[model samples]
Target chain A: MQERKRTEIATLGEFGLIKHLTEGIELKNESSKYGVGDDAAVLSYPDKQVLVTTDLLMEGVHFDLTYVPLKHLGYKAAIVNISDIYAMNGSPKQMIISVAVSKKFCIEDMEELYAGIQIACEEHNVDIVGGDTSSSLTGLAISITCIGEADKDKVVYRNGAKETDLICVSGDLGAAYMGLQLLEREKAVLRGEKEVQPDFSGKEYLLERQLKPEARKDIIEKLAQMNILPTSMMDISDGLSSELMHICTQSKVGCRVYEEHIPIDYQTAVMAEEFNMNLTTCALNGGEDYELLFTVPISEHEKIAEMEGVKMIGHITKQDLGCALITRDGQEFELKAQGWNALSEKNN
Target chain B: MQERKRTEIATLGEFGLIKHLTEGIELKNESSKYGVGDDAAVLSYPDKQVLVTTDLLMEGVHFDLTYVPLKHLGYKAAIVNISDIYAMNGSPKQMIISVAVSKKFCIEDMEELYAGIQIACEEHNVDIVGGDTSSSLTGLAISITCIGEADKDKVVYRNGAKETDLICVSGDLGAAYMGLQLLEREKAVLRGEKEVQPDFSGKEYLLERQLKPEARKDIIEKLAQMNILPTSMMDISDGLSSELMHICTQSKVGCRVYEEHIPIDYQTAVMAEEFNMNLTTCALNGGEDYELLFTVPISEHEKIAEMEGVKMIGHITKQDLGCALITRDGQEFELKAQGWNALSEKNN
Candidate 1:
């Protein structure tokens, strides 16, 4: 053996590291048509069509231990990752979980975490196919990748939203955000005056909306049953304004959402008022609700209106029209694209 | 609005958590035939073979910051993850990488990490498809699920090894472990006991092997050229013994390895002696070599020997015969299955 110099990883840029690592990888499976370069990796089983997507959840940034229950956290992790598949109009079939925990966690703790994961899997009827468990030096990390299948003709892409499409959202907006606000406030109250029991009694729905957000899997099924194909679909994670902006950008169109029509849950509305915050602000900028935000052809508007839990909020327009919001006061305003930039910001 | 009780994830085990989290998931696409319940999730793409495999690397367990360069670390992340797919006799197409970083780090440091990842991707000719990024309070984590493809007939699993199959390893073992020893030595010298400019000049190969190991993509290519289908295959990640055990367990057979046949690079051999450790132990238990450990039927032995960089280390036997190692000194010893357990202890 001869001595050779090795360069450190820091010397390479992010792009450089990825290039060097994946080079010379040859795909020999006829079933793996695409890998590693798209929004989702594409895999073809012998008898099925599937799109795969994965994401990682880090403690602190994605959730807080102070208020989040381990079970809810587990459930939320599954919903978030599965949402990506649903965004593509795919039926989620299975998921693979990987977790790294610190020694501070015991087997009992891990069991709790998996219980939440199992609950989500069962609700969705997906199996806990495979996973890797490792011990970390600090905190906890969870990575999940989900596979979903859709008919070739029914699968929708973020680019499919067209001008004149009706933009809709299942369930109300901003409830999750309001719930988070209340949680933060309660934490502050406990930390400061040590007075009041957080007064969460009246905020059950909003709190549940935040702690255990669902992926709107039912809505996806409903759409299929009604023979409706969304022009574009995405989960409302980073607030309505931000998600709406994403739809506009990805679809190369503009959107106009009516303020009065923007559905706000009753509990979220009450809580926002109690907190002395604008109801619209909470709805527009709150992230992590996991509700489905999608667009449909205008011809289906009447049909959608008759469906339960579905609300029509806006319409798509030509690119030059730009994204806007018609306020309750009859004032029109431009929609900003900024959401929670988790990386650049310190405080949420 | 009413306050609801917070659920603690610790109450649910990892399995329970997984179940809870996956509830209510609906599959909308016909393409998603399978998800979350098998060794690997299945995706169906037209006219393409399926890609698959997984790995999760935790901080502190896999590397020591005192010696590993960030660039090498990043590249190694991709290399290790992709090795799983390779072990399955599949061509890696792309990878989805998800990382959990602590708040102590900045974007610049992350970019440094990604730089190494980029370099690795380029070398492997893989695309930087999609991944998730988030922050942790401390310690960094990376989970990679690789998508790959192989002709149905060419794919190999651990269960395929049979009686009389020749067990082989590509390149060498124990070098990476020795490299770690040398680097630790140099690090100790630099930390204290002045004037000890360590004689690290001649130890570069071992260090690089430890720090920036490469996956056996070349051997995979060669196997295709020679039209060889391995009876069983796996990457030498947790050491040779551990991998062999996987094959033995899965194939329901035993193995017999000859001590004299195991290959050890010159530098690794010397380092093993200097450390007052048996060179054989290093070869058997030292990990992270990232080489291919595979089995072939006796009929293919001659053809395998003709290939470059392939070395036969052992042979498979009937289950009742059991796994054993015949030492060069004519001492026969029973082989036990043991290696680093990620959920328990990582010797590194």
Candidate 2:
């Protein structure tokens, strides 16, 4: 490996640093008429409804720098917002990222973070249009706002689901949550031993799910090709149970999800067993999966069943039925959202 | 005053708290088709271009709570972002506010902050659309993104100034910076003396300017009514001299601003004299005025002079001339940007 060069941010000042960081950025989206260096980014989206979503991630609260690489942190931050845009069945076109870092970070650290952000934008064909960078008193803080566009008639909302709509989910769940657990356990063990290495053999999938999850743009493209528009949709960041509750409450309906139909990767299942946890419980309530959970008309169930990476989990029901899960033994129980609640767990 | 009710944020959880805070937010912009309670906010500006800007405010680095009230902090945070939209000569339509607070804040504390934000939004005709709230490990963090719209041909940029164009400013300068100095002095004095109240009896204008600065939307509207499109425009958040340098550098031009032409309020001059500082220096380099700075063709000088609160202070010059200020004593001096560079000042 080559030696890396470092520069102090103070030398360039705020304006100079911003200019340096965004020097070679090329706007890929036609909608991005003007980007950095302007008072505000100028965009044009003719005849389309624009979608906007924002997410804020703080150090110590959202990630542990001891285990999370700055590049991965940057990538995950952008993807998280992009996933929200995708959840509305919109295509992300531009993003504005604001970051605040303490003196502990050098210019090289910011470069690595921006590199990761650029990679994610390039992969999604999105434009890095504008941002604000400042200094924090303690740790790094990142906030991303993604702008997307969709045809006015095709955008999906959480309140559009109807009774008898088939519930579907793309990809597997709980891997990211289990990956977080694995990293935490390793961090704890390494605290006592100087030379101990994390034992991550055969668990790259879980780690990837946690460190580098991608938004389900391919799934959305496939759905469009299949001529299926989800009645309602949302991304699963706060666990399946929690997101399901949001859709149900917004649509004024309930759902019946089958425990066996919930997809779980082998590594997640093995890790659950090692930790003496129920696989079904983790699949239902573990968060940070970044998977698409949506409801389609029951009449299109056959078409969805033929698609790859999508599973038919259950069906929507009237409000009186409540959100519940039918177990393998045919026992029905009300689902509780045990996802991370920042206010109740950390602030209060 | 009636006693206010207090509630713990933990009791309502994150979702419930978001609902409570945004309970009656009504979208008044035609571009805002959908707001809050969705994966993303939906907007449409079919025949116009959209402008977006973001700003981040971190505790300790940006504001000191000992002297800055939470309501004022929240209001300033929103105005700062809105100012950027006006700087682009666009009409702000919507904003998304994201805040991260520590355990020390109660539900009522958040209510106060939101009230300030709501007031700003209502006054500006901008709707609160979508945002994310999380818990921080330490002090408060606020990030606001403002979305605005303008006709593609009417949007002004900082690189359009031409030689001989008359530079103009809306309102006076240095009052906000002087106000900040006063507050800092009072905070230092009150640290050791328990009974000393800040003697702000005659300095109400300075305190209000510092605590509740407003974006110059009125200036933009008036300029439109006058049919005088500025060649280049930007808000004076980082002092007149610094922002002038930005315009000069970007437009490949230089400027000669007359010392006597710079506008300074009476309170600002008195405060500078009391502090043994040069009034001209404060007017040139003191920041956070939230005033509009623009240049118009020399032919429109008479019209600009007739407008209320408008002052012509300078004229654009060739790049070879360099950016300078002609003092009242018949001497010229180069301008330096002494604006707030948080990275160098606080973190370093």
Candidates' RMSD to native: 11.9, 1.4
True contacts kept of each: 0.38, 0.81
Across B236-259, the per-residue lDDT of candidate 1 in tens digits comes to 877888778878977899999999
Error of 1 at B110 (Å): 3.2
Give me the overall lDDT of model 1. Answer: 0.73
> What level of docking quality does candidate 2 show?
medium
DockQ of each: 0.19, 0.77
Worst ten-residue run, lDDT, model 2 chain B? B339-348
User: How well does candidate 2 score on lDDT at residue B125?
Assistant: 94
The residue-by-residue lDDT of candidate 2 on B1-348, one tens digit each, is 578787767777888878888889999999999998998999999999999999888998888888888888878888988899999999999999889888787789888888888888888999999866788999999989999999999999999999999999999999999998999889887897775677898899999999999999899999999999999999988799999999999999999999999999999999999999999988888889999999999999889999999999999999999999999997999878876566666544
lDDT of 2 by residue, A1-348 (tens): 578787887877777777778789999888999998878999999889999999889898888999999899889988998999999999999999888988888888988898888889988888999977888989999989999999999999999889999999999999999999999889988996776678799999999999999999999999999999999999999899999999999999999999999999999999999989899988888899999999999999899989999999999999999999999999999989888677766433
For residues A233-265, could you state the per-residue lDDT of candidate 1 as single tens digits?
878777889888877886889989999988888
Candidate 2 segments exceeding 4 Å error:
A1-4, A346-348, B1-6, B346-348
Best by TM-score: 2
Which stretches in model 1 have alpha-carbon errors above 4 Å?
Answer: A1-44, A47-49, A191-199, B1-44, B192-199, B345-348
Q: Give TM-scores of chain A for all candidates.
A: 0.84, 0.97
> Which ten residues in a row are the worst by lDDT in model 1 chain A?
A9-18
